[model samples]
Target: MADDSDLEKTEPASGRRLEQAREEGQVPQSRELATFILLIVGVTALYVLGRWGGHRLMHMLRTGLSFERAQAFDATGMIIALYDVAMEGLMTVAPLLIALVMATLVAPFVMGGWVFSTNILRFDLSRLNPMQGLGRMFSTHGLAELVKASLKAAVVGGVGTWVVWRERDHLFGLMLQPLEASMDEFASLVLFATLLIISSLALLAAIDVPYQLWEYHRKLRMSKEELRQESKEQEGDPQIKARIRAAQREMSRKRMMAQVPKADVVVTNPTHYAVALKYDPEKSGAPVVVAKGMDIMAQSIRELAKEHGVPILEAPPLARALYANCELDQQIPAALYTVVAEVMAWVFQLNHWIAEGGLPPEQPGSLAVPPGLDPAAGDPEAAR
Candidate 1:
């Protein structure tokens, strides 16, 4: 079943999975691409050097031949002469060497940028097992690679053979020419053959790029079960997430109810809306809503306020406005500050009267609730 499940994986790999694979030093790469680029670099370097190298070699030869017998007899002069000759050779060849090294280094980074991983360094006893090794050698991936390599070799050999045969007449005629002329023609022939070989490799690389991309994705494909597990890992178990959300809502409700007792007064529409306001000179420039809710939550706030001896005033406009516009623990909008101030002043007067055992202060008449501050009052559509 496990092996069958592995075979059943057909879904495209997710971005995260591809990224993980890259981190483990697995990525789509074509050996032919590397070879092709390096061949091109080699051909280019040879052509460039061949033009300049002859003049440089002639200069070196002239310098060597012109050296005085007195300089050769002096040990220090001989050593200096040898050093100059070595430096000249190194400098002449350095660019081609640099080109080859750079081509080799750049090829792998072409697809997946540079990645350094220790995955290949890890010891795996399974790799050492003869049975597993033999199985790997005969695997579909192994067979595909072997077939691809054989095809590349055939293409290269065929192209090289055809180029050599085409140049055979020119090559044979070179023997009839002067020494320097023949050498030049030979160099051109070799360069032309190299270019033809490079052209064949370029064609192979073009095919290999897409094949490598498809094979990388195929190896990283996920099964239905694996897909679900990955999604669960990323999004979290749905049941646990729901419970966490429920707990958060409960905690928020508890915190809101606790604030009702600290509110100077709760303004309500008696049934639908409730807003508990707190004013502290040290903490706020204006009255802040410690708690506000509507419908069932509004009723809960009113009940909690009443149980805690927090004053409740029936103010439909203020309650509606506060519930619509204010957030819990946030200050009411500046437009409503004047209206809220009047209510707070009235509440303080009423409390003072009750504490003194005097007649309760006259109920505040005609509270100046701001026009268009309350959504019920402000929104024409709600009223219609």
Candidate 2:
């Protein structure tokens, strides 16, 4: 159970986004919306042009026929009329078809900003195994498809019933009209029916948009195990990383200890922490931390300082400050000025006392007897 929780925490969200994009055939909204607008505009323009041309052609045919023999308007004339109508219909649809084709050609670039891949059609025969294919074909998504089909059928059937009922009176009245009046009425009826069908289709498309988006996201969700597997592949095992970090720490400890003997003073937390400091009056205005470490490393630094006879001071605040702020070979910060000055003053005092005849030169804090030694350890009045 604990392992499962750890795995869940490490998963990346990018895989889910990629999967959703794949499942939905996700065209960017800007592109798809543009294409839809163009389609509507193209169809509407073509429809208006076709209606105008057809009306003019019919008007001309009627006028020409009125001047000819009554018997001349026969089956042969009707056949010619049908041919002319078919040619005009083809011309009307040609512009819409051309626009649709152009839209398809530009769809990918507009949708994706740029196309990075086109390898979706690469074939894999492994997907053709009968049992596996059948299983996929009958999966949960396949079941959801049945629901979509039922909803579409219900919407279309309901719209068809409503349209028939609403237009029944108009349809009946058109059938009873005289021939010239009947033709106008029939044209109007056909146009109204086409408009209703297009409107119904548009409504169906709007309803489908949300359902398709949800289905796409559901298909994109990765199982917990899949998430874990992807993370491991990307970042490697944690144990190996920990071991590498430990090796690096060991190497750093060796380098830090080598710099300790060159330090002017070693400050400490008495037992746990050790920080070595160095000062150069000619080069730096303040002391700098040359090395610092805690626990085993602190003990090693203290031992080296003792062997070299370097002064050790137990100042907890100074040691912590140096350890936290200073790096190897850097001058100490301005804020630590007073504390470091006090440590340096004591060292200078001890050196001065040793230089005079009144103090022992070898032992730092011991007194020594001297014959005829000046009280101030130099010219008495001048030292005072």
Candidate 3:
């Protein structure tokens, strides 16, 4: 059942999922790759400095063995002599230790890069569950690890055996030779054997790196249901989003209605559409549509305009055109400039007449908007 579930995860993991996994300290790493790098550094360091180290060791050994008789008799002198030998040994090995440390630092970069997540440090009780442990031990991943280990051991062991067997006669002859010459020959043989083992590891590392990356991504794959759930979590619930949109629209409507009382004139379809126009000689050369609405919203705008003593003009074509084409707080289109100019002239006239108490100024006649500008241009009922 578990295997079937794993197979069912056909979708690739998303970027967010991968980032979450990284934050949790879960990353693809091949032990073989790290081992290969460290060993390579070790072999290079040894190859370059081996002869110098060997000579140093020999000199130190000779000095320690040839200590003065008086110094050997004195405990303080003997202690100082022992310390000198230890210092010499430490100096001879310091280069190798440094090389190994540098290799350790660089090895992680070749795979998962450097990760400093603290999650891995936290203790988990699941790690102590014997049933889970047993399941992991028998899992396919565990079997693959076992196979890789066995193969590595076989390759290294086979190469070592071959080197020893091939150098069998030379090995016996070395014991009969002078110690110094024998030591050099032994060092060469050992270096040769080490290089062969490292070569085998190179092959294993090459294979393991790709396998580890593949396994990492495969484990992170999402099921269809999981993908849908993640998408929903990211985008939010549709019903809640709709409610938010509805509230936004309501607030926008209220704001539009508030601007109606400040309009210079309210052009209306008389019953269906209303668009409030405002003109500011200093701010804009042309009239701007301050508020517009249809049906119940139009009724509200008309009632609000009447309450504030703003003029209401019945111009079906102009109202429909302005309502359909013009956005709030934006100047009317250039194509309807001539008709809107006449309406503005009439508005100036009306304001003067009301202030000076003369006969009411005649409203503009047939304010004809451009063709295609009116939403209901061809409808006979809209024209009426």
Best by lDDT: 3
Count of residue pairs whose backbone atoms collide, per candidate:
0, 0, 0
Each prediction's RMSD over C-alphas, in Å, is 4.9, 11.0, 3.1
lDDT of each: 0.84, 0.64, 0.91
Clashing pairs in 3: none
RMSD of candidate 2 to the truth, in angstroms, is 11.0
Per-candidate TM-score against the hidden true structure = 0.81, 0.59, 0.86
- What are the runs in model 3 whose C-alpha is more than 4 Å off? 1-5, 68-74, 269-273, 280-286, 294-300, 303-309, 331-338, 351-358, 368-384
Residue 177 in candidate 2, Cα distance off native in Å: 11
Ranking by lDDT: 3, 1, 2
So what's the TM-score on candidate 2? 0.59
Tell me the tens digit of each residue's lDDT in model 3 across 7-29: 89999999889999999988999
Tens digit of per-residue lDDT, candidate 1, span 158-182: 8778877988898899999976677
Q: Candidate 2: list runs displaced more than 4 Å.
A: 1-43, 46-94, 98-116, 130-137, 140-187, 231-237, 281-283, 324-329, 345-384
